[model samples]
Target: MASQPADVDPAEFNSLNEDFYRADPAETIEHRLWMLAAFLADESTNVGGQEELSLSRDEAPYRKDRVQFAALESTLILHQAAETLLRLCLAHWTDAPCPWFEMAKLRQPRVFPKKVAHVSNTLDTDETISELLRIVSWSGDQDVIEAGVKWGYENGWERHREGLRELIRYCCVVIRDGADLYNAGKHGLAILPSEKGVSIGEGDVISVRGPSLTVIERQVQDGDLRWAKVTHWVKYKESIAITGKIASAVRSLWECGKTAGLVVAT
Candidate 1:
């Protein structure tokens, strides 16, 4: 490869030269999904070398940092697995053009659809979840994906669809419970110190004074304030259970999808 001239505009040149968007083969995508599934299954060290059953900090034998990191990572991985599976379903099962929001992210030759671009420029998790629920809802009318699965897999998708619904419900609970804790890890976990700083978790109500306590100091710590500890965060055992459910769901869905994909391929 020849080195570019020092005077050339690097950003523009790189943009022009890069193959930003390439549609991966369905087989490759399937393989990636399986890899994620495997990661979820190997839960040997969810909270710092301790198993998921070790819920309380006392039994975990690990610092809070490690515990927090594992919890946050597992939550994120579960969400990603579900999102990717849904996207694959949309791509393979539906004939509708790719959502403009997704298209904008890809580096392709196709022009963006301006009219729908504004409305569909982002991958809405809620929308995807809703669509997935609808597909498996057992409604009288069959969606494209359902029809394809029935035609190709001969009812293989039926059980998987039921499993998916259960997994979806579990994920929703995990997301709600873990959202604040996960966000706190990314930002900083706000620790409120009081002489009575007993046990606390998410959603434990308390009182707050003017200008929330951002800073802590001996001199400024003069106020009778009360606030609730947020307890929505999932513990070790719960995290493990959630990941296990996700792994099972993704595995089942992938197997069924792959079989159906091959049938259609033939």
Candidate 2:
């Protein structure tokens, strides 16, 4: 039903289609990473105190709302970037044809390592995390490594797999722990700026005072009821840390892709 335009030759169009099929995977991954870097840069500029703000009492609420909006959007962008990194990692490990589309159906972080495991018998989720951490050479930074170790110690993660697991759990995985807010933002738009607190006595209370956010989800058994589940405490510092980790991982992947391409060329 479609015909080539008079000005365009059929042979040239067919050659273009062939070129598409023969496109370089490494170059494709680089382009995706470049776009992701642009998104991250934009998010950073908006949330990194670069924007002017009024300190007047009358404009306090407006300033607070603007900060909350930036936090929410930045969190979403970081999560999406993590997923993109996971997909790129899978593609690099598998070296499969049309991997972008082939792995498009996999949306869960847990499943990504499992898919990689299929390609390699010994590389499980933890090993995959370790590989990524090693590639990034995060151990060279004393401050970063110490922070990861401190977090792992506080959270009861094993010393053997502490730093590796921490990176995967915090910056990479997005199913259970760091996922509810992202899912809520994407699906129901049920995130709200709130405080996390607990009642102690009739008139007393213990509260974790901070600028935080909560995600509300519909009750599974009772669809009519909405459950205010406190998911993330929305720390901008933590978001920035996670973004840095993702950026490091992306850079490592770019280098690895280039090395792999060179190997194949020889």
Candidate 3:
């Protein structure tokens, strides 16, 4: 950023920011409205050096976007105006997380807005481009944002990739990758006791026999034997069809057990 005029003091900035934060939302936004006016007062803050941008006009698209993305009240609307448009969002300028990204960390949904709540965290310099890609925000240009996030994550923002991935998932980016690993074939699979009987952890594959439905639940127990959680497991689409086959298998087990004089639960 270019240096401010010598007359423009920096010491008052903290007080200005504090007052801005404490002001009623309207007053806070009014202050930003004035800042926009000031930013556009210079011809440089516009599409061309010949024209000064008009917030009332040019800013309307971004304002609408912010309203949808953050659900900003009338008072806090200026913050979004200043951050997304007044700052680095210009096509010719460098893009970076705004300084207030830290402020968003200390504030509430009101400050950061709930829709893009993922970006409210304090973003460090080390945060990779990939990490930023995972943040969920409403850009009218979803495709552009998605590409930016993906590029951000894969490039310098490695640490933030998971977070951005989570945001992308939250936004329903489609075709998530990790749902097929745990499945039970036939009687479907159930979390049953291992031959040795230790609890299974995530990603451990265990064989379950006679499961009317393959249940990928937390390990449970029946008498001395452990069973997987019966009520809360995800049923795989393809393998779930085996439930009927397992039911027939169970009936055969019941008949054979009874013929052998073995007791069976109802």
Candidate 4:
């Protein structure tokens, strides 16, 4: 690392320190991986199911409503991560390029019941932790590595803004049990399988699909999927404002995206 010249203005050093922390979450690879892992754990959450009746009440046995079970069920795959034996279930929708986005779906440090997927480092703890340490050390370079990290924070945020919001909303579902309107609505019970696969993207509202009706953030399921949250159509109406804001952000993002040659055709 090059030391600053004594003649250099001290203000330059102070300004750099101020902006760097603001960029820390993005610039630091460790933090990015940490956030990504957090997001993965978030979206991977599924609250209620038939056999899992922790949320049901005595008087209202076999309750079909889901709102009551706000506490809901939570299953973390393992005490270990990446190396543990667990099925790597890539959240897939169709047999299309949508498969690529799997990389961005951040997950947690959890080991599933079986080992279904593996990254080069995941199989070995020594290498994985060592590589992370290397990156941390690399960040000390300031010019070469730090600049690239800062660029990632700036660019990844700009590139995946809407995509990230969709991720964030799902995150809300995991962290805030009450906010999981889909899983926490009504009795938060089961009738049909909430096979309702919701794959929200940059310019889309999360739509929960069922055989009979496809609802956005609210719907009951019928199939092998699992139990679903009931929708209070009236209360959910207010979410339109939030929905609208997401749409607008996606639109602005798309418009700007074209300049960077990455526009998604809605």
Candidate 5:
């Protein structure tokens, strides 16, 4: 009798291949952006509900840390979605071979600026390249383009050079700022720092988690009698707004791209 191999589940394995790695590039980008947006929106809702809960009744200090961590995670998601969208836009609209690769290398911000700048040269002749560069500058101003070019090897025209520069700026802010915070959080800076620490007082509730503590204090003067303790809680409302903005911006960009006939043929 032939024994059935436990690890060989043909039906399950086939189902995984159906949509996991077979999505068309264009559709995949769009779908991923929407999926990230939905996740961020859910996080926003959770944070809001948590805030309301805190307001209605006394929430354990740990609740604040959990809500803030969720917000930070949402920020990280928004940043990733923004960068992916930029690369996708270039791939869809640019004439350069390997547009996505060029865009990724160009936006490195630390290394390969020179390499990225030369990417524009791959588009067309100097005249078309110049025009494309001009058009892609966040502002249509020559000085702005020149400044961008001077600041880094970024010629700003990776994709045959047609894009919504204003929208690009909006998206960049979210991605860049969120990236800094996200990196910091990932590297053991998850707890936001405060100038003053909460002092444990009689009858005051204190809940401490790993790197996260509940503290409520405005400022501590020298020689204060109360003991100062650090907290891991963070204010999440601002983060929530930023994530929502990023999601909205991506949706708007997608709509604009569709109107401009940037869909991939099935």
Candidate 6:
């Protein structure tokens, strides 16, 4: 016969029950943004480490591969974060109840940009930009303000709102460009490192180069063909740089939203 387990303490059990009940299990857009912020914050450390590795002279095996992987992962996170931020903005601006689950179902590349463009056309005027800047300035974060201003200046945008619109547009582009890669990564798509050779007719090679990583997909239209399609390619360092810009954009929008009372503190 098995020995009986020791009895649990009633007081301890009661305390645990009380704690569980006190915790809020409900999810909200604010909570989702907070979670994404936390994820990006964690990935920032990884990005820094990858940057260091890329600059180092160490000849470790697969060192380049590691950097490339970091870039891919960071870009995916940035795409998701940007999508969520845009959804939150749309919800607030339109006074519609755009919940997280509903937004998650959106075909980001196809649907999000059109909606954002419509809203911007109607509301992103110079006056509104001025109002947004005033609200952002109230946050007292010089870095956030300067980031948007600097980006605007670099793009030759005269108005701050133009810069803001550009930033959002860039995010949409990232989502569109990365859609195949993102879906591949999420859905067990086969990826590999590969190179393409450039040569003359008689095999006189000019050069050979390709993306650091490539995603492989079945050629649905030509299933009878022997070769699979190289659907997407990622230039590792360039992708990493793009991820940095996305992060900065997300931070600026978050700060602006918080200051404007669009986002609540979690």
Which candidate number maximizes TM-score? 2
Pick the winner on lDDT between candidates 1 and 6.
Answer: 6
Worst 10 residues of 3 by lDDT: 172-181
In order of appearance, the predictions have TM-scores of 0.36, 0.52, 0.17, 0.21, 0.36, 0.49
**1-266: candidate 2 lDDT, tens digit per residue:** 57633433433433433343354444444454444444444533234332354433422234455556646766776776666656665654444333344354455445665663342443345556555544343333445556655552453334434554455455434533456778878887778865455547666655444557777654455556666565455665566556666666666555544444323321
| TM-score for predicted model 5 compared with the true structure | 0.36
Instruction: List model 4 lDDT by residue over 150-261, tens digit each.
Output: 5545554334433433433332332333333333223343323222345497655765542221123433456455544353212222232333333333333223222322
lDDT of 2 at 225: 60
The true-versus-predicted C-alpha distance at residue 140 of model 5, in Å, is 13
Off by over 4 Å in 1: 1-69, 85-163, 173-232, 262-266
RMSD of each predicted structure: 12.8, 10.8, 31.2, 21.9, 14.8, 13.1
- Model 1: per-residue Cα lDDT over 1-266, one tens digit each: 67633433434433322221123333443454455445444444444534455556523233444444444454455544444444343432232222222323322332222312321332244454345544333221346457655544566455555556556545444444444444444356443211123234566465332211122222222474544454323343454455555555445444443333222211
lDDT ranking of the models: 2, 6, 5, 1, 3, 4
Candidate 6: tens digits of C-alpha lDDT, residues 1-266 = 67644544543433433332232222233354344344434522234445556755433325444454544565465566556556645543422222232344344446666775554554456554443344323322345556655552453434544556566666666655666667766677455544444556566655445544467554455547444556344454455455455455545544444445332333
- Worst 10-residue lDDT window for candidate 1 reads 209-218
lDDT of each: 0.40, 0.52, 0.30, 0.29, 0.43, 0.48
TM-score of 3: 0.17
lDDT of 3 by residue, 188-218 (tens): 4322322122235565566332212123533
Better-scoring candidate (TM-score), 1 or 2: 2
Error of 6 at 248 (Å): 1.8
